[model samples]
Target: MANAVPVADFLVLPPRLDRTAEMLAESARRRGMAVEHLSSPVVPARLQHSAGGHLYGGPTFAAAVAPDLDLVPLEPADDWLPQLPYEYTHRDIALTTLGEARWSRTPMFVKPPRDKTLPAGVYVDGSRLPGDERYPADTPVLVSEIVTFLVEYRLFVLDGMVHAASRYAVNGRLDPAPLDACAHRAAVLDFAAGLLDACADSLPSAVVVDVGLASNADRGDEHWAVVEANMAWFSTSYAANPDQVLDVVLRAAGPRHRLTLRDQAFTRPPTPFPGTGRSGSSPMS
Candidate 1:
């Protein structure tokens, strides 16, 4: 009998290995996959590239090596949140340019939909947003009504199912717990299923969705609402099952040739060349 080939031939990591990256690499190695930690943003000449290679790093690192490795990084559509039903979002969400958003006199939550170029938080008003000189006036942003989340959960979804989940935060603080150990596991999965049933088409097959128990300040009511969608390749596991997280990460940022027809639309456009952009700037590992 011959040795079986690994599902993913290679798993690439950034120069600095965080706990989450270390966890995924260990999981990948146990499954017979090779792990590569780049010494710098540049791919070394000695390293061989393969179509079966998958990357696990920030968007900047992905963009840096994409041209050479032929990696297809999957992310949610820019308008994914804005298009969702009000029942899920529980707030007014709009996709607009920074120029237009800067004119608003009222406070709101503003963030760059896919990238972390602009900070994600509640701004006092449009005037408090990053200056136009730092980000182009035309830079796209998601502006929404501010709501306080009492608890937050991160779900790693594959093929419209929650493969792994963790309670990442509570009361705006770090509080990691595995889904199986969570008291609200049933409610979390139930809410996730409903959202996926209605809006799975808006996201990639392998992605992360953050849902939270949000409090309405005026009404004093609490309900489940979507926090946001994130790329599995860039999201932190934070006590999620490492094996399951690896499963999604492999598919979310794997070989271009292995991408299914449904995921092709969600793939990030190829970077034409390396060393053409910034690096080391992801909110999550």
Candidate 2:
């Protein structure tokens, strides 16, 4: 099966309990397949196969174990969702080193380049970031204009097509009831398709793109916007079909990835960064 790489060919080594990897493993076992879980963080020298897991500690851990294993391609947080050419579903955002944000006393959404321990939130000024001391004072971060998303969906994309999608959140909560997908299937799919086309060259062959309505207003002028892109291996599946999500996961960060994908998902090396409490491994994962 194209999606059925032997469990032995992959490793499960999430920093903690990664429900998505567990679900995939369990589902594979139900189908008479075998998978293994490595309790230790250290990957053996001889190990050279795909692994499925999430960043429990930080990117450094993934970076540490990557060389010894063939885990799904974990793109750098900063590199996964680069600035888009136009304001599709994304708001105005900028990336800069912490030093550059020192004097800025404006309210904005600030977060690490990738998901990390540091919480991403609105800070009145760059100097007020709570956990900035945990990382080097000069760590990089993303500063974006604040925007509200009434509803959000996670789309599993492979080869520029949305294979599976689910309504993951609503009004700042985990209400994975498919409200958005059910009510706006055409709009969501259409918007995702066009946005994928517009940003295809900037994204990985397999990844997760989060999209949401920009406004609660019932007007044709209102359109969906890009929330962000995430590494399939580390991202939650939400209410998306497990089988379809698994297919995407396998293709996104599977054994075949070495030949078909880029060496490093990010343009730069992993730096000391944290995540906003809003993102990372979820209960559904």
Candidate 3:
């Protein structure tokens, strides 16, 4: 048989590749692309030109590999998509950092703006927040009104279009099911389109925008609401079409990416993979 030509390439961490990463590598190989599993968690300089791009675990990994590729590294998820409604006047949703948190009597969903150092959960009142030992007192956080997600979907967006999406959660649980491309999927996509249009200029060229069905008695019915944004490099693919997700992954961290002024401030060391007892770091914080 004639030697196959490569269509794409991958740079993955060895020993433990997440299901999504594994799927991407397998899919790429199936298509005659090359995948290199590295033990050092570093993207070698040689691959910078030969390989399409690298897929990192998180911002830290991306930062580590960036020096090898001589490319601008990625910013934290929070910085990439800062408190949307608060940063952008067009968004009605309320979002603020824990330090500046002013909500009393009302519960809010709080989570670390970038990494999983802090667990994401609903705080009945700001007073109940765990002590600030984990992160600095001034650490940025996402504090938003608790909204119910009847069904949540993760969309892989690229340049104003959603390449692929998957329903990953239902009623705040880990329920992954392929959404029919009919009414249900249409509803989710429609909601996403409206959101993207509303905040067209605010979002990055490539990122993951999560949306969900929420019921507002005052509004009288269930409608779609923003569930916050995640960095495309780190967000789980869930059940999203693997091939489509891989394509987004490639473009999201492709060579065209430029370093932001904030990337220089990203000096924190790499975080360990989740559930790997090898590392003392916490996962899904």
Candidate 4:
């Protein structure tokens, strides 16, 4: 009989590995996949020539190596959150250019929708946004009303299901807990199901969605709201099952040729200059 093919030829990590990356590497090894931690941002010629595999890293690192490795990194659409129903978002969200956003003088939560080039926070006003000199005036950003999250949970979703979940924060502080032990596990899953049913087309089959219990100051009530959707490969698993997280990561960033038609729209466009590499300074989380 012929030897069976491995799920992936390699599970690639960025040069500066983190505990999450190390943990994922161990998980990959246990699944009979070879792991490669690049020495730098540059993709080795050998890896570029070999059968492609999946990459696990942040946007910066993925941008640097994805073209050379032919990996397809999946991400949520820029307007996804803004288009979500108010029940799911619980806050006013808008997609606008940094140039236009600079005109706002009121407090608002602003962030670059697709990348971390701009610091995401509740800015006192538009003047606090990074100068147009640093980022292009036309850089896309998400502007939303500020809402405090009492707790935040990360759900690793596959095929519109919450495959694994972990509570990552409480009252804006890091506090990782497995979903099994979480008091709101049922509510979280239920909320996620409603969200997927409403707008699964807005996301890739494999992705991470963060939901939180938002405190509505005026209403004096707390309700579930989606914090945001993030690339599964770039998200921190926290206390989520490594195996389940890996399942999503593999599909989120894998050989480009294997990409499904539905996911084609979600794939990060290939870098124009595939050979130009940048430092892998970004964290996996």
Candidate 5:
């Protein structure tokens, strides 16, 4: 009930029906929620309407819309640095090259810093790690310290509030094992909320905080670390519980706002700097 916001869908698929915002919105409607669809004429030609708040969409969406809507991104804009080799963030940090992470905790799980786009992987310092089915080295890969965990958990925060959470285990040991769900929940919420608050002004409408079991000094205790930050849009919802995620998005993605190209919305203006627009400036956001 705290996330009582109204939302509309901005379809990025062209009049061609190439995307799923309509279908997804319909599903929400059946659950007694309200969603609106915008007409192209009112929006800027270069602009698009996307669900999950474009947190995972192409940088173009952010570039075009940021100037019009006061949206801040939890992650970096696309085209910053290569994704962090692992699934963690220092918040609002930028990586200009792979060399920044030259010294890293080996056996890391490299993942991309930005979400929604492709050509990313979780790699080790130089080993041929598995999970390549989802991440091939063909594209730029994120090299991170490999973290094996009792389980991986995700927390979805909406408007500075803790809304929903889910935990996953490649192994089912934690299903009923003696693990403290509330503590992990608390850790994820505390860290993510602080990070979000740090960049609260630019926080997107919806985003997911992924928490991993990092090393702890408790000897045999399972340690938790913030592995990867992801957008709520295309996250597999595997480790995440379905109903809870859906509910949070439905509530957070609200009150459709139409901003004209001429309107000034986003406060943090990007510097055109002559040649930056030709390609995405940085890939990390």
Candidate 6:
């Protein structure tokens, strides 16, 4: 359904991800849908021009604050995630520190949280930071403690259904290979449920579960833990075959619940940036 013609509605990114929203829109139009793309207010450019604007027939389009957008509910029955959203540190520090441990493993995993996904190839460890490039003295870097794991998996859920699943070894060192289709499905289901429970208000119409290698990261290499929750728009199914994932996104408009976008503000207590210090730090501000 998502692919069949933009279906006379406007598609939009909630608080961010303009490029992604555009791509999804393009795919829909190609299938004969006429759609309009709007960036979320997270983008200054979008926010600047958001006020006093309108779009297609579906809903009022605006790059307003996240609270302003009417998102759909993803309420789960109970606690879904085995643990909290994966707490990750900087990749450079994660890699650099883990390297010091001499991991007997091969495929090491590295992920930066959604708030900081940028500058491609910036591994979790400090290894990615250039030796010469002086980071603003005020910038602070967060890195994950090196961890070993066993199985790796990916889950795709659309409109609350387990649409696609895949398993990976992620280069062997991580030992997430020999994908287990069934295990991945269950993991994804659990994750999707957790997302509904944890982020019911922010529950988007769609989402993809990026289950971490289900190995114990704290005990042995076979330990399993939740890695991080990623936005459906930001995640890519390494093995989303049959491509039904696309159609699900389209049909989602059918009886799909829409969360009212509350016009509020994202007031995060000011924190120091990466590198430098408050008393004597460089300035990017």
**Candidate that beats the other on TM-score, 1 or 2, i.e. the better one:** 1
Per-residue lDDT of candidate 3, residues 1-285 (tens digit): 332332354545444578987888877777776777776655454564333455646654565554444333233345533445432212233336665653455776787765666678888887777666665556677765565678888988876688888888888898886656424798877767776777745655666877877764445667666777766767888888888887766655554244343333422334454443322111234
Model 4 Cα lDDT, one tens digit per residue, 38-149 = 9886776667734557889878788777766766888888899999999899899999999898899998999877677788898989888888577778888999988899
TM-score of each: 0.91, 0.77, 0.75, 0.91, 0.48, 0.44
Candidate 1 local distance difference test against the native: 0.85
* Predicted structure with the largest lDDT when compared to the true one: 1
lDDT ranking from best to worst? Answer: 1, 4, 2, 3, 5, 6
Who is ahead in lDDT, 2 or 4? Answer: 4
Number of colliding residue pairs in each model: 0, 11, 0, 0, 39, 54
After superposing candidate 6 on the true structure, give the runs of residues whose Cα lies further than 4 Å from its correct spot: 1-7, 10-32, 35-111, 115-128, 131-142, 157-164, 168-184, 187-205, 216-218, 241-244, 247-285
Any idea how many clashes model 4 has?
0
Write model 6 residue lDDT over 58-126, tens digit each, in one string. 111221222222222122111223224443211223322223322323333433233232232324444
**Alpha-carbon local distance difference test for all models:** 0.85, 0.62, 0.61, 0.84, 0.42, 0.37
- Expressed as tens digits, the lDDT of each residue in 1-285 for candidate 5 is 132232343322212221334455555556664443333212333332322232223344434343322233333233332343222443223333344343444544444555434334444554334334444434343553333555566666665555666665533244421123444656656655665565443434455666666543334445444555555543434434445556544433221343222222321345342334522221323
- Model 2, 1-285: lDDT tens digits are 133232344434454656776677766566554454556546544454334422222244454554345443545356444467556834667887666765678877777755554577878887787644565556777777777787788998887899888988888788885434478788889998888888776777777888987663334245578877876766788778777777776665544344353534432332322341221111111
**Candidate 4 backbone collisions, by pair:** none
RMSD of 5: 9.7
